[model samples]
Target: DRVRIFSRRLTDVTDSIPEMVDYAKTKVKASEFLIEGEVIALGEGGKPVPFQDLMRRFRRVHGVEDMVEKIPLRLYLFDVLQCDGKTLIDLPYTERWEILASLAPTESLAPRIMTRDPKVVNDFMQAALKEGHEGLMAKSLTSDYAPGARGKKWFKIKPSDRLDVVIVAADWGSGRRVGWLSNYHLAVRDDTTGEYLVVGKTFKGLTDAEFDMITKRLQELKIRESKWTVHVKPEIVVEVAHNEIQKSPRYKSGFALRFARIAKFRDDKTPEEADTIQRLRKLYEKQFENKGRLLKEVP
Candidate 1:
């Protein structure tokens, strides 16, 4: 039997995480299956590691065994699209999950509970959070599995926080935002050096009028321009909301925002008043207070 893994972008990632492939071959009971599962890096006491560790495994082309040993992965299967050459996507979630549970071990399946009580759901969310998980997913039992689409049937529960950050640059928008400068590069101030370091970028949560206004403002503040990006002075401040703060090697500050979006413009705040990298570092550290660390530092 042959098996393949894919990234969210649908790229073939079977080679990147050989342990997953190996697990499927040696551990999985089904001979022919197409499963939807998430591979999470595990740390001490079977706790999930940081997002960067999981990403590091995905990006590695060699020394995968060493990386796998350093940051062990656990696959939690949620949906079984196919099993034993039988299609399961059209089946209801309850049926499909039942079929999936039969094919995989309980340890390999995502922890789930069936309940309609609001208080039970809240308590489950709290349990998930206490275990260092971001949140829990709520899915309608009657709904069939749909690829790449999140409808009312499926909901993600999580907490979000906001911080004032400066826009250091922006990319030219396409489609609806045609001539407007969008896809803002978000950064935090370095209080000690008086410089701004990029943490992430996003073009979410903006109105047409706000887009027009910000485009004009960025154009006026533009210090330099490139083929796709316009570099600007980090003077403007905006409050951006994010689900999580992640350790990143791509940015100079070694931090990035996950699911970040502009909440509102902070005209009352200046660049100096914006959140600093030090503050971000503290927040990042605070995130894993209950969770076990996979590694002392990113490998």
Candidate 2:
């Protein structure tokens, strides 16, 4: 009895009818149900297409059948809230899992199972990391499914790999960072030459307290001013994390950081002890090699 159904990713109305009708026949007797799943497009060799490519498939409505054939999908379902004439909101997660497990089809049309077991979850998380995924998500088994709630029941674990580097210069801040210098030009030491190589710049992850403290400290250490960047004494050490590394001409080191964000300020570390440019290059290469092996094992 689905009077209306809407999906952002799904386009094949004919293919979806049987599945929806079957779910309606078996899972619902009086009340309606709303289900959600991630519809991911697959690449030429059955790999997941990039998010941008998925966006293209999501926009076509008149040529939906052609779009479905050109860009296939893999649906990953996680939760269910309503079934039949009863609301499952009051039920514990275990009860919902039992019902879901029993009713869920196991053929090509079924959604992959998601679990909360620490060991199993950890394994999936590690695999995702090795496959270059953003991060892992952990959910409490006892928690109820609350739509649109950013509760403590769910937690996201991102890779905390960071490089401690020295700050060479600062940029004038605007708006909130006006007057005081806030954004930093970071660099890594060159072990052989004892020189610093400009690697990246970042202005994120600073708390209000940290912003005030850093601005005051930078003002004291400012030696000279340049057209775009302000020269400062190499005294502050900051740790940053990034998704990947890429070669760039902007930095003298021949490489630039990508998606870098501040982890913390290393008050205990000196500029002499900061990570070297060579070491950062080695780490990036190692991660790339490890990711290659992970993609082969996923299928």
- What tens-digit string does per-residue lDDT give for candidate 1 at 1-299? 57788987897878889888988998778889888889888877878867767788888878777887888888888988888888888899999998888888889999998998999999998898878778888999999988889689999998788999999999999999999898999999998999899999999999999999999999999999999999999999999999889878899999899999999999999899999999999998888875658863545
Scored by lDDT, model 1 comes in at: 0.89
When summed lDDT is taken over every stretch of 10 residues in candidate 1, the lowest stretch is 290-299
* Model 2 lDDT tens row, 185-268: 889999999899988888888887887898888878888988656888989999998766666778899877777778899999
Report lDDT per candidate. Answer: 0.89, 0.67
Pairs clashing within candidate 1: none
lDDT of 1 at 116: 80
Once fitted onto the true fold, the runs of candidate 2 whose alpha carbons sit more than 4 angstroms away are 1-113, 137-156, 293-299
Estimate the Cα RMSD of every predicted model relative to the unseen true structure.
2.1, 7.7
Candidate 1 error regions (>4 Å): 296-298
